[model samples]
Target: MCGIVTAIATNNVVPVLLEGLRKLEYRGYDSAGLAVLAGELTRLRSCGRVAELAALADARQLSAHIGIAHTRWATHGVPSERNAHPHISGGLAVVHNGIIENFESIKADLQGKGYVFESETDTEAIAHLVHYKLQANTDLFEAVRQATNELVGAYAIGVVAEADPFRVIVARRGSPLLLGIGEDGMYAASDTAALLQVTRKIVYLEDGDLAELRRDSYIVIRSDGSPVEREVHISSLSADAVELGKFRHYMQKEIFEQPQALAQTLELIAGGAGITPQHFGARAGEVFDGVRRVLVLACGTSYHAGLVARYWIESIAKLPVTVEIASEYRYRESVPDPDTLVVVISQSGETADTLAALKHAKALGMQRTLAICNVPESAIVRETALRFITRAGPEIGVASTKAFTTQLAAFALLTLALAKINGRLSAEDEERRLAALRHLPVAVQKVLELEPEIEQWAQRFAGKEHALFLGRGSHWPIAMEGALKLKEISYIHAEAYAAGELKHGPLALVDKDMPVIAVSPADELLEKLKSNLQEVRARGGELYVFADAGSEIPESEGVHILHMPEHYGMLSPVLHVIPLQLLSYHAALVKGTDVDKPRNLAKSVTVE
Candidate 1:
């Protein structure tokens, strides 16, 4: 996924474009570029973060009242200045996101017309095509529309012209683009986060929509050339929430923000003694009543949260639950039930595969849908019938922390609501769980105090080449999440196996050099998990156990134990993941890897 920001304002837009790119850099950070129309088109591009490109613009004193910018996560080409966004041709500059599928044929046709390419990107082809279209028509917006007609894939494009210095043309097809209307300016960007500093009111452009932006106002047109109006919603995200105040990195800030995230997510039921489907949304009661089963779709860390929700849903709601990786869900042939509740979870609602899976489920006649997301006006949130916004704030780190825990909190609320509606949970039981939900913030805060001990364990883990994570029952998914966090940030080769499956085959890989991290909370599965640790020790494997305070797991010659302050029961996964997240962060910090922006990993996977 790449990010695009366009602004036409009373004041110079160079600072606005740079600030917008900085806010949206979490979406994509491989390269950054901008096209500003001063007396003529001034195109500047770079192969790194937004700050680098901003420095270049500053040195050159690039200034304009109208402009478009892009921070890219490269798709068709490598991260280089030539392959960066703001691809320019004669009299036109274009910045694009998503794939321009069939660009090779378009490139060949453009080359035959004596238009040579500058970069290896499919975007260069679109730039030349737009310039070619402008030759037949004098209108910039008309040329952008004609070029979009020639393209065959997804795009959110911003086009500016040197001849039409005060105008910007934006178009979107199957990608995210939104317009912000302000008294002094008009803006368009890939996300609302970039526009929050200037405007809170936004109009989200639908698929196959085009817009013409000028200094004072904007006009929207549908793909068929008819004038249209989109709804404008007020955003709740504050500019202060996205800022990293004193935290060293976004990962660390998000990890510590868990307590507040849980507190806010659970605030509606803090002192309540009951749960109902209305907790999710106004129409959740009607939707939950028709739901016969549950199907969850997610990717990456969100999928692990879905897995943990599976256990909660099946056991508490007395309904069968199925979890699938969103990417694989659409490719396979499977039976879809119209009565099933399709739950899609994503931190950024723009995740491409998850959105595709939601559409597939809807296409298969599943009308009951719910999106657990962080962004309010994203694609998945707009598409779903009901939604639960996690309110974890802007998660800038590639590795998710607060979003995962907040999703779990939301899923726990979902479980309680479903259980109460199905008569599986009595009013008293519901009240008890409600109280536990309210105390989740305190519980997680207690767990966060163990960071010093976890840092010690991280010192041992950072030097290891490979590691294993073990858990049983509900905690198995937590183990998987821990392993994922470790590998994602620290670059350590790690794997997770259910503790019961240790003897089957994984034991052979355990040796003195390999460290096995075990989740040994005081649940019913703890005894069996202890036996699994013994098997690891017998194989000359070093054991690292994250146990409850009095679980009787002692630190021995080959056994290293770090006890959690208390047992959290059903909510233990939320607390357990904190240390693992800290361990990964510290490990990466010690290893001198990029902690915030991990190599080859972006915050959101908006492309297929």
Candidate 2:
């Protein structure tokens, strides 16, 4: 994933373009560049964050009425100035997101055509192709369209021409691109967040769609140059969605908002206003009742959510479940039979690997596919037969916090619904679980209140470069998720181990500087997890635990506890996750890392 922004206006547009790039910076930060048409060819590029590029552009006085900017997450080449975006060929410049699968073949052919390439990026090939085509056809739109026809695979392209300084052309394949119409100018960005300040009315470009924008007018067209009608949808996001408010980082703001996010999700599902488990309860039962097996495919934190779902489906729904990492699931030739039900979980609902896995399962004739996603209109939601939306609003942070908890809530609700349909649980049992589910928001809120203590503990472990997360049973996956978050944003090398597996091999990593974060919530495995914590402490590993309020934590040793409210067995994971999320947030804050936009990470992975 990468961020792209284009602006064409009659007046100065550099400020607007810079503001939009700042909004879209969450998408990528490996490098940043901008191309401006200021009566002459002018380009500003850098090998770091958007701030660096902005400083360089400011020094060069590169202001223009029409421009395109990009914040790159390097995929085709190494992160360097030579490999940055806004690759220019002759009088044409282009910025792109998403991979060009046939780029090597295209590059070889273009090289044979006597085209000199400046950088080893797939995007440079497109610039050369556009320049070559414009030699025969002077029209910029036609040249871009002809160039895109030769390219294969995913791309969201923004192009500007020195010959036509007042115009900008954009096209989309598999990645996202949006158009914002304004009074004096028009803006094109990868998401609404980038253009919200300029205009609230927007148009989302579908695959194979092209748009030509000018200072006074904007038009949408099909790939073949035929005019098409476009819908301008208004965004529901407010300014506060992007603001950190009182929190120091978006990760921490998002972590503290989990109580409300979970509540909103539960309300959406239980309120019956939109799609919910009740709508699919009977159909889900019918599908799973005759099904012999279940498959869960996801990536990153969503994958950990699936691991938690595996426990619920096996224990409550009484079904055999398998969790597969989406990236690996499609590469393997093992295909699910028609009788198996496949569940795909994603926060963005546009994760590349997960989408590929869904397609692979469908191609294998697996009919019953369900998507649990946060974005209601995401690509995966449209492709799946059934869908459940997790109402965790606008997760701006690159690392997930509320999305994980909401996915767990959705999985738990799905499990209960399946149990009711399969006759695995009686009406009383279903009601009891539903009641527990209703109280989860409050339980989660209680755990979130422990953030103060968790932050205090975070300071003590901030100097440590490595940590261990230990849990057993359902908490094992929660521990894994915690460790992953810590490593993702904090740059801390953390590992998760099943309490029993600690001494097997991972225990060797433990030392005085290694702090072990244990998920010892009050569950069936509480005693076993406590014993594991003791084992780590005996080895000079600092013990930081999230324990139940009434659990006996040994005071004789160096046991630091952030007590959580006692909740039902399955619901504890959702509550226990908040403290760990806060701990990671504070740790990353202490480390002075860019928590919202972590290095070499993007908010969405739209390209394969």
Candidate 3:
């Protein structure tokens, strides 16, 4: 979970590298540093945010036209100045994202060869490896190729050499990296946002691919160093994609845009001419035909999406589904037969844990793999046999909003496809469900109208130190996601519970000082949720709810209600989530927290 940016140009590159790091700090910010190919022997590295590091570098007068920068999320070592990236060895310095699983062995080998390491990071091993390789051969590209062949595990690496001065070598194994072709220079970044300020023309690095960047040009090659042709994909993302628009914060804009995002996603899945029910249904059916079990693997918000998917699969597909957090999934010894299908969900399609989990599942001889991702060309999408993309556009906010709704929409569609494949749903049932899915966008639009009320409610609850979110059935995961969003962006101590579980333990935490936000949509569990709300109210917990528009729940009783739009069974979670997102956004806004870039959290987890 770190960010890497490299620029190769004839002009000054330090400022460009710094600007790119600022845009990419959402990826990681525990520590930041840059290695520049200044004069013949100048390189600077410091710790902290890019601003602080840049100030230190300025004092050192390190300048260069070819450089690499990194914003690190501590994984292999403590967050410290020396552990920060752009690690140096001889005249070569490198910045890397992702973990090196075999670093200890490599470090021991290097130490036996009399190599001294200045940092405890796994990344320092690569710098020393390159330095060792270059001593035998001065060719930077050849050295990197030789050194990388000896390494194991996921990495997106960028390196610069003071000797070369004009070239940057970049490579990717199991992480995300992009090459941006600009008029002034060529760039390499871990994400598109970093290069958006320069150019929209980019070539995403495939696994085992390497790129050589120079001031005027760049070329792609395989791991073996043979020349390879590249396809340049123009990003459709506008500068506005990163803007807050009329909203107070990017989180707020994202919260309000949920309706449109959901609508667009529904249209893409249901109305897209190529996405026939037969295609998705037949594939899903064939995959799950005699499936003994299902495994859902994902990370962070996607893991919550998988939890909700488990509920859907078990209830509708009549198949048992196990949801595993990707980070923890591989460490376990449980194995699934070939009859099992593993579904991986991610928004960026490059989450390191999720990718590793997919690989682990494949290594276990499970061939049936499917991906639900937002980015169409992400690493997960390319590696999976089947893919479903969420049309959520670019979600720049560190804490996801639109991506969550779009993922839910994709999961709901997958449920229908599964039902159709298994013959569990009749034509009439399928049509009814499809009709409900079709209406979700409108329902989401209505929920977006609750923002003003939610903002006011956020004002009331802004000063509270802790809050609890409660829901039942499918809404349970929605409650969990809502709580996660609040705690992620606002730094609030928020917890989620199944409404029925409140009395079991969480009820003890309820008090007037702790506001309880309950998702009480009109469903079979509405009455049960209402009773749970009453229990919280009895315990002096202030109640705030987003309830169905015509629900029989009391509008008085000191309860603050934001009327929710009507939705059919199982679809209410998608609509009900909007207000909770808004509540968190506004609460963070009122608290004056950095809603977009929360502390100690990265937008994407690229390193384990």
Candidate 4:
């Protein structure tokens, strides 16, 4: 994901634009740039961070009443100052997020027209096309609207021009864009946090909505040239909430925010009223009552949440659920049951593959859809028939910590709700699950107290090249997630097995040098998992185990153990994941890898 911001104010907007880019640093950090209208379009760019771009703008005294800025996660071009953002052409500049699928063809068309390109970015194609339209039409908003029609891809754009220095034009097709309305100015940003400092009055721009922002006001128009009035939503996030206060990085801050985030997610259901399909949406009760089966589509960490939910839904709700990676699900042929409830999970809710899979399912006649997402107004939420917003606030970390836990928490509620609908949830079961849900935040908090212990294990992990993770049943997904976190942030080669599969194949790879990290929570599979650990021990594999207090597993003969105060039963995965996040954070710190922004990884995967 990339960040785009622009502002039109009665006074110089450079400060607000720079601050907006800074707030959006979590979205991207590869390169940043800004273009302003000070009698003429002046563009300043830097290769490293928004601070560098701010310094460059300061050096040139870049002051303007109208400006556009961008922080880029390189997609079509290399990450460099020359290819940063605000691609300028013919006195007009454009900042764009999302891929341009037809850029090569558009580039050829622009090149054939003798329009010289400066930056090797697909964004430059939009600038040239806007310039081309500006030549035929002098109206800035009309030119932008016309240019958008010729493009074929997902995009959120902010355009500024020397010809019309008092106004900024903005539009979005797939990526997010919002308008901030204040007394003296108007603003456009890719994130609400960017505008939280300027104005709490936020307006989410829908797909195909084009807006023109002037100093005092703004106007939004539909693709068909119809005037549209967008609803203004008052935002609740504060600047302090997103800042890394008393924390080393955004990832670390987000890891600890799990307790608060999960509390917010569970607040509505903590009253003992029990979960109902209405928690998803108003029509959810009707849909849930009709569907005979469930099909879940997701990717990465969100997919792991679905994997864990498969165990909960089948056992507790007695429902048949099929979990599929969204990208894979869209390409293959499947039996599309109209009675199936298709559920899509995403932290950003704008994942391209997940959105496409939701659409693919809808096209195949599965209209009963649900979205488990963090963002309230995202593409998946807009497309799906029902949705449950996971209140994880904003996860800045590239490797998900709180979002995954919150998703699992949402799944727990979903499973109980489904059981209630199917007549499988007894009054006693409801009381027990709701009590567990109410106590889950405190349970997660207790888990966070183990960070120092996890850090010690991370120190040992930092020296290892390969690791093995083992678990069983619901905890197997936790093991997979732990392995994913280590590999994603720390660059560690880690593998997870169902623990029973160890003797079948992965046992041959076990050695003393490769530390085996086992998730040995007190569960029904504890005996089988312990037998698997003996096989690892006999083969000279060193083991680090996280076990319940009464599990009887101890630190003896090359095995290291961390004892949990108590077992959380069905909700153990939520508690077990915190230490793994701590492990990844400290391990990445030891290995000196970029913890928040890992190599070749963007916080949001907007493209397929």
Q: Clashes in each model (backbone N, CA, C under 3 Å)?
A: 0, 0, 1, 0
Off by over 4 Å in 2: 59-63, 224-230, 269-291
Error at 506, model 3, angstroms:
2.1
RMSD of each: 1.5, 2.5, 2.7, 1.3
Provide the lDDT at 50 for model 2.
77
- What is the C-alpha lDDT profile of model 3 across 1-608, one tens digit per residue? 68899998767888888888888876657888888776774555666667897797778766778888898888888898889888888888899998899999999999999999888899999999999999999889989999898889989999988888889999999889999999899999998888888899989889888888988988888888898988899998876687667877666777777777877777744652322443333365566567667789998888888888888878987888899999999998986689887889988898888988998999989988888888887988887777877778877778988898888888887777676667788877777777887878777777777677787888876788898999899889989999998998778899999999999999999988989988887878888888999998898888888888767777666687877767457777777778888888888888988887888888887767
Q: What is the total number of backbone clashes in candidate 4?
A: 0
Model 4 lDDT vs. the true structure?
Answer: 0.90
For each candidate, give its TM-score against the true structure.
Answer: 0.97, 0.93, 0.92, 0.98
| Each prediction's whole-model lDDT (CA) | 0.90, 0.85, 0.83, 0.90
Q: Write the per-residue lDDT of candidate 2 for residues 165-251, one digit (tens) a residue.
A: 879999997787889988889889988888877788888787788999999899999898899998888777776687778987778
Q: Give the RMSD in angstroms, all C-alphas superposed, for model 1.
A: 1.5
Model 2: number of backbone collisions: 0
Error of 3 at 223 (Å): 3.3
Could you tell me how far off, in angstroms, the CA of residue 517 lies in candidate 2 after the best superposition? 1.8
Name the candidate that leads on TM-score. Answer: 4
Tell me the spans in candidate 4 whose CA falls farther than 4 Å from its real position. none
lDDT of 1: 0.90
lDDT for position 372 in model 2: 92
